[model samples]
Target: MTELRDVDFFRDPNSVVSPYSYMDDLVQNSPVWIEPNYGVAMVAGYDEALTVMRETETYSAAPMIAGPTPDYGVEFTGDDIDEQLDAVRHRLPFNDQIVAMDPPQHTMRRALIMGLITPKRLKENEDFIWQLTDRQLDVVLPRGGCELVDDYAQPYALLVVADLLGVPEEDHPMLLEKAGVAANGSLTDTTKEPPKKHGGLEHFYEYFTDRVESRRREPKDDVLGRMAHATFPDGTLPEPLEAARIASNLFAAGQETTVRLLATALQIVGDDQGLQQKLRQDRGLIPKFIEEVLRWQGPIKGNMRVARKTTTLGGVHLKAGTQVFVMHGAAGRDPRQFDDPQGFDIERPNVRRHIAFGHGIHTCPGAPLARSEVRVTLERLLDRTSAIRISEAHHGPPDARRYDYLPSYMFRGLTKLHLEFDMEA
Candidate 1:
């Protein structure tokens, strides 16, 4: 473990293991601390993060994948280099995905993909999720315990998203085997040299691409067929590959968000008998509990953004093309935005205002799905189990417990969660 003052958020695994302390140190110093190692302005305050998110013209998402020193593949020396970055956008990682593009294109594509998650579709998906969660528990509950992450959350979330996207039933196994969430640590790896290939949706990209093409050949009235011929708000049709990227991204993101969130929820519920009893008795508290979980420790630790031009935020100057790591987890814990910010309060009066889902146009589209998935899963778990206990064999005793976390600065989640549950009498 490196010194708190010298920790490299990108390179050091320790940062991923226990980032809260490091984040606390960073936010204490300033809302926007310029890391000397990478020259990244770590934006850890809520207000500063909002400025960076809202001022899209001033901070381009083009550098969303900056690994230490992101090579936008071009150089410029001026007050505004927005156009220069745009010209070399193809050379950047995730360039084709909605997360990387700037305005106009981003706005149009966002409008197009927004159709995938209509209120009607979400309601239908939630019904399926409740059934799936029971089916999952049926497999492990009889055994008296399970590793929630792999045994339950992972496959449960995968199938839910598959059903949502109308992925053929037969394809679920292939996705289960191949479409595992690519770890965020591998993306911003500083130890590796430049030009490393990014781990994308893997075969899912090609599979979806072929699905779109087949729909084009013989149209069927399903989600795939509609998306294959879907158009941007301006009536511009997207190519098959372009459309496939959106599908695969949604699939990957939905699974990852649900799995991480479920593990986090269980981790807390397993030990806090008082909290579990509260949630079980007053089931309405589940939504507030989920928001509190997000505020307490979001699935993503933070995300990186870049300055598109010269700008000032939180009273600090940023030059053109400067990279900023927007600390979402830190922002939630900022005392300025949240009173007793570090405390977990399910009844937080303004809990809905938290920026855990991010802000502005780039806010996570799967927020609703993730919330429902967890709420349903937790409700079912509580329904079936009279008591849930953290496996001391795996995690030690309550006061001096040990837990393993995912090794990625971009994602915050327990790697595994072992729970011993007593079946309902």
Candidate 2:
């Protein structure tokens, strides 16, 4: 048996290059097993992951980051855990984000966020998605082939979220750069020492503070205006920092995952011409195809949770404060949950049940927007191209396709996707 220390699941760059095969081995040993490397409990089974997510009281979302909170030079010495946590958060760079909050606070913050992306707003956003898709395709289609990630996916997702948030068109590039850094900085890379504070977070705080204050003074007719004007359930507006936190969180969180999803979806279809044609022939199947792609190759690999109290999961005893990793990618491949789970089947009836967007309260609030982006992307790509194929020069032969995924354990996406497409006459 390979020792846990020998298996650096989250840290080792080479190990993360092809994580699913590694995850398969880990899941086979046990659905919920203690990773000896970090001593964090890893839950890989679909049911087990859901168990952890649904039982929020037993498992807190407070410690969503993989490793110890950076020292931040603040030594918290206190018997009161809440007080200690509060002190710790005050010192951390991005403490006020919703993902790191607990029940009452999380509930309220999520509600405010939900209000900002309301159904009417989403409907309006949906109507504009086609226009956005065409804008990207107009640039890409003129060229014979392009790298999908940089040329299309990243920009499309970033712009969509930017539009949704009412980020001015002029500031999209800068905001995307900052949010990209913040998103990438959040992932733990075991090879390096953790920084006391992420620079991106500080940048976001400053950027969003100005945006929030400006919106407060003169509310525009857009999503930021809604967010700026939004009140807590108690009828009080969020403080400047709190409003900044909400806006920055939305900016950072919404874009990257969706980019990953788009890249993965395009990669799958680009590789399998038959599957690509099937969806192109019948556009109605695009939604189901997207769902299956999410189940089979979702963007998020896993997320972190902490045991709020000593509890038993999958027959393994866990102590309070123990960090738990809910392996969503692994869970999607659990045989108990999906038959022949590795196979991609668009016709699969229960494919939507996969926790690609996660489960429970922390479920991605931007799931609707993400789905719309992907659907529109495919609709446009297929309409514009007669066929799409992986660039053999870049990815090698079909039998031995070469692709590079993001180095981080938390994200699953091709760093680059080179494609050759035939334009529609």
Candidate 3:
């Protein structure tokens, strides 16, 4: 077994920037070892992670983010897990968010969310993706070099999601400002400090409440309008706060993950000229390339699930309420599942099997939209750029490059990607 004291996977600054080296070690030595540092079970094996995800009855998706365990102030020596969960949830700020709920509650809320992003809706939004991509590119095309994350990926993602959610043009700045801060301190951040109530939720709450009220008064033909008047499976409209929570969850969750995906994809292509040229030459490979990127450098590092009952995972006995970190990043490169798992091969078969967007019922609902955004963005980028390369001054040479990833155990993305590209004449 690997020593937990040797590597602080959660709080270590280096883990935020580059965790694959550490993950590779963990997967090899201790696929199911409990890290004494955080006192949480780390599930690193590909099959083990999937088992935890698929068996939702045994694993609860509550407390999707890692933080200090909430104190309900009562010691329960009872067999009723449901009662214990209810008591603990009462203290969590995001208890009502769809991702934090288990069946029955999650079922209805997820239904309402699915109602908003139907195929037709996503297809319609797909058309807007090109326009949005080009508009952002126009801003950076004149400049030969730009920081990809701030100048392009971040704003582009925020705009696309804002447009999809029917956020007004005037409110764009506020949404960006508030959501940017909240995205960093998301449930995935591994700091030991107690999780504070996110301000972005408050921002979205007010914004969506007004929008929902407006839609109720005068309906329109947009996603917000659909969500504003959406009903549960039982034909009852969600409560005002519930409606706001749905919108807020969509807004925050959708943008955060997509931004990371875009930045990571761009960084990969930017750093490898030969691969960039190959992708540029054969546009058909864009989808496959995107899939490989998700497998190799997916934005989500892991997701947390609590054990709902006593269960054995990877031969380790887990009691109810134990937190499990399904290491998606590690699982993608598990040699048992994929041959040459470390290589970034776009043509690799089974690349789509990666759980970057997660798996089972809690799989990200905005995945389709995220995929579309990445595809359109890559297509337009190759169309407009003659050559795209990483800025060596910002990140060092190929032998020793310096890239800083987001400081969160749950997310894997560079904080900034500086690139120099020549626009096609």
Candidate 4:
């Protein structure tokens, strides 16, 4: 049997997605394989992925990326990946962002955020979510055909996050533009330079810093306002810079992930009228559909962690400091995990088991918010549109479309998505 190498997977995520045919072989042959160049283990099987996630003691989130810091700059090397990840675990800027920490710290931070996402808050946001969805649809629905990425998905995702964070409606337009630019600014290619990379981390820091200052002076009911006054169990709160980082993370990750999810779902349902009608007729199935869409086309491609000690994964020996990427997208489609994994069946029973939001301690803190956003937005679209179809301007089968996914190996999302739909009948 041919041994699967992790280097190939990291260097070429696009090839791993398709009829390229090598993926299945790689998965079956060596679900936990090593990347020759990066010295990272590629974990693709569902069970193994879960193992990596849950075993926090042996594995660390330290090697999550190769960046020093978002604003100042942090060079992420194999060594720094492990060290830096460990260092940032407890430094929650405002309250407990939770995602950056481990163990007891992670638990405490998570509890605080979870309290905010209670059923009451979700219910309260129901009408608001639909209103935002409608605003997005109103613009795109009139166009009849437009790139779904910018026209619909981008706004939909940002608005959803904004609603939860209590961002002002007036700031929506500027925030959306900045978020998009930041998403596209990940490239390092000098030849064929991108349209614009001028205003990214700089602009983001300025925006969040200003927002943080405003919240400090005049507290409101939104997340920003809450963070401004939040205190840990010890009665201490994050410093100014830390608070800004938390907000920056929420803005960047929230907008990008949801945009990808929305685009993926539209592409899937738009390709099949029967599926669209099924969802439209029985809105009850919308939640289940959302779960499946997450399973089939999860936004995050993978996340990096480091082995804290020597270990053997997938029969391959991994020495200490070896970086491992928990391949969520690959594992979601793993044949071992779900039957007919390649097909997008909304009614799939195992949909809930999907690791799109991740597993164990580091599961996304904003999951409740994401679930609510997709469910409400999709249901409202079905309520408003008579028929939904892909814009001919963009061509491809549901899964084969070329997603201008960010260059980063960590987060996966499209740069643009073109879609079309009919007016209400």
Candidate 5:
């Protein structure tokens, strides 16, 4: 009752683990081919994906997290549906949020976040990251084996983002419970009763609103304080709710994505002892490995953009309102972009060029923090562990391994990663 050819990425459970062959076939056919099953134009080519990202005026980002299938509640037509889309945008889910906004609104709101993650701030955060990695490892290393996602990845990533945002130390456990398991867990599991399109971020919204209002009355020398005080380029202060939404997006969304990257990095090393030893010997390759991990198993699988106008992408014509799903996983491995795309080469020279964080203005601002999280975690993990191994009892033998991926259309993350390790005396 299921078919691999003309497969639907969202519906097909089989495609979760082995999507590359299907992705390869798509790229071979055309960069932006509309799926026969679903009319969505799947952008699989590296250059083609970049074209859609760069041409911001021609696409409506409302579909990015709006839904798997977007309906503006109004028809889109003509060579330019910019005005049409704008008129009905509010009707679309979360139209006020950053990822859903267009031009002027997006530009202003995005600057507020970008301003907070300065080089100085990131450097300070690195110290916390190094120490936190050890603290997390301290708990798991003693057990010798642990479900890496629940024990380490989720908590570590949540706290790192909390520290970055200056979230109150006392509130961490509550935030973790709300975000770490319940919110993040439900969000990645699509089978939940209510749709899980960023419900976790709601918990952050209420928390940040109260905090941002407090920061406004009595300013503190901290990241959230700066964010609370940050004004639009026009010098107008953001509404408390508006500021809170942005912070929630940064806090909750940013944390979950990084967790996925961390899980994948650990899985890679756990699966390959040789690679683990290679990394332990040369810590410098950790950066390259992180990039390669991001390229190969990008945290975000697809970013959808609704066509604002009738346009041609790689010679394929798209009608207005068509949701062009940009496949980061596919595009990163496109043969035209990288020499030996499928093969995981940590030393791949042009590796950084992959749009794992995206290519243009809409690129993820938290990318540096994510890269740091992986690098710091890997360094500490390798240093603290005599050896890292995929738990044969849980994942089966390497040759005939079994793993469960999070059942979500938008994200790429392990549902659970079980690992056994040797403690470094």
Candidate 6:
């Protein structure tokens, strides 16, 4: 039997925990090695990934990933996507979402979203966030030990976004479940049919639609209601349909990504007593530590893009219809990009340069929201638990320490994050 090579780890990302193992070789040997299994070129080096992002002129982000678009009874299929897959693509609402779009149009959509999670709004959520954190911890902390992902990360992510998006508390669990199935599909094959299908998004559309209508009836002081009544500089309010589409996108994308981060951060800090102590001692460093962990171990694995025209990258020529897979997770460990790339130094310089949030016009707009969720969760979790560690080996396999990564080629995150902690202090 052949051994697992650096390139092979990416072949089944879910099975392989360390995506960075091949970083040194990729940086030195072949930064832009094409993978035959996935039928796309993989970009590993930091410079190359940035080049793909910065030179949008040569490398387009419009077709970031290959899949079907959500039809939703709308006539938005053929212009940007292939015609044959219209039926399949019609089910995914991401087509109208910001992450799937590019400049000009992308700019307009982002402006509307940015308007909602503004500086003042983020500041407003801080107290509410901590209060919510306390409420959640109060329930779990007493247990002394819990599966962080199921007990904490999942709920934390759901409520944080629900509070900001103004999702009524009662409706949160149902919405989170529906959205979770859809998101899990990007990781594994189990999500082929989300329970709601178009229903999940339709539910969102209705929810936001009602909010917009209510805001029209009587404006409220929340972002959703405000967005319900927001207008462009040209006096054209985003169509009600578009507004719902944007809201739906934010809820789904933001929620899953945040859940992954919270789970991964705790897993990393939980295993290392020293790291946990440092964060617990100085709660102020939690935010910076979150940033480092994002670079060190982000939830999203890669970004996909389609070639606009014949172009050359890393000395290889790409045709217009070619698919390029930019491995952001692998890029973070590129030696050329960071000295001692594999080292998880929380205080590393230029760590902000990581491609975790992506780059260029399509950069993730919900990044600030994700950062806030992680920071507050860690601050409170550390405050409650004096020490955290992976559970005893006698209770499980020693190799279980490896993060059971997600199976999807697009997003990479932990499937199960189990930890044992002592709160006796």
Say which candidate scores most in TM-score. Answer: 5
- Candidate 3 weakest lDDT stretch, 10 residues: 181-190
lDDT value for model 5:
0.82
lDDT of 6 by residue, 85-188 (tens): 33343344355667766565677777877777778877876767898888877876776666666667766665677677767677766665654532211222
lDDT of 2 by residue, 273-380 (tens): 899889988999999998998888898888787676678999999876666899999999888878888798999999998999889998989899999999998998
Taking all chains together, the TM-score of candidate 6 against the true structure is: 0.84
TM-score of 1: 0.93
Report the candidate with higher TM-score, 1 versus 6: 1
Better of 4 and 5 by TM-score: 5
Worst ten-residue run, lDDT, model 2? 181-190
- How high a TM-score does candidate 3 get? 0.92
Candidate 1 per-residue lDDT, tens place, 1-425, comes to: 14776878887887777888888776766888888798899998888888888988888887675565777766666889877887887887787778777789889877877888788878888888888888888988998988888788778877887888778777877666565432211122234434424444656678889999999999999978888888888888888888888877676567666789889999999889999999989999999999999988889777778887888888889888788899888888888878888788999987787788788988887889899999998898899999999999999999988899887777889989999989999
Instruction: Report, for every candidate in turn, its global Cα lDDT versus the true structure.
Output: 0.81, 0.78, 0.80, 0.66, 0.82, 0.69
- lDDT (tens digit, per residue) of candidate 5 on 1-425: 12445687777887777677878777766677878766888899999999989899888788787655776777677878888887887777666678777788889988888777778888888888898888777777888888877778877877888888888778887787766353222223324445545555777888889998999999998887898899988899999999988877676457668988888999999998899999999999999999999898888887788998898999899988788898988899899989888899999999999988887877887888889988988888888889999998999999998899887767888978998989888
Question: Model 3 misses residue 350 by how many Å?
Answer: 0.6
The predictions' CA RMSDs to the true structure, in order, are: 4.1, 4.5, 3.9, 5.5, 2.9, 5.2
Q: How well does each candidate superpose onto the true structure, as a TM-score?
A: 0.93, 0.89, 0.92, 0.81, 0.94, 0.84
**What C-alpha lDDT, on a 0 to 100 scale, does residue 59 get in candidate 1?**
85
Name the regions of candidate 1 deviating beyond 4 angstroms. Answer: 1-3, 180-198
Give the TM-score (vs. native) of candidate 5: 0.94
Candidate 2 or 6, higher TM-score?
A: 2
lDDT of 4: 0.66
Better of 3 and 6 by TM-score: 3
Write the number of the candidate with greater TM-score, choosing between 1 and 2: 1
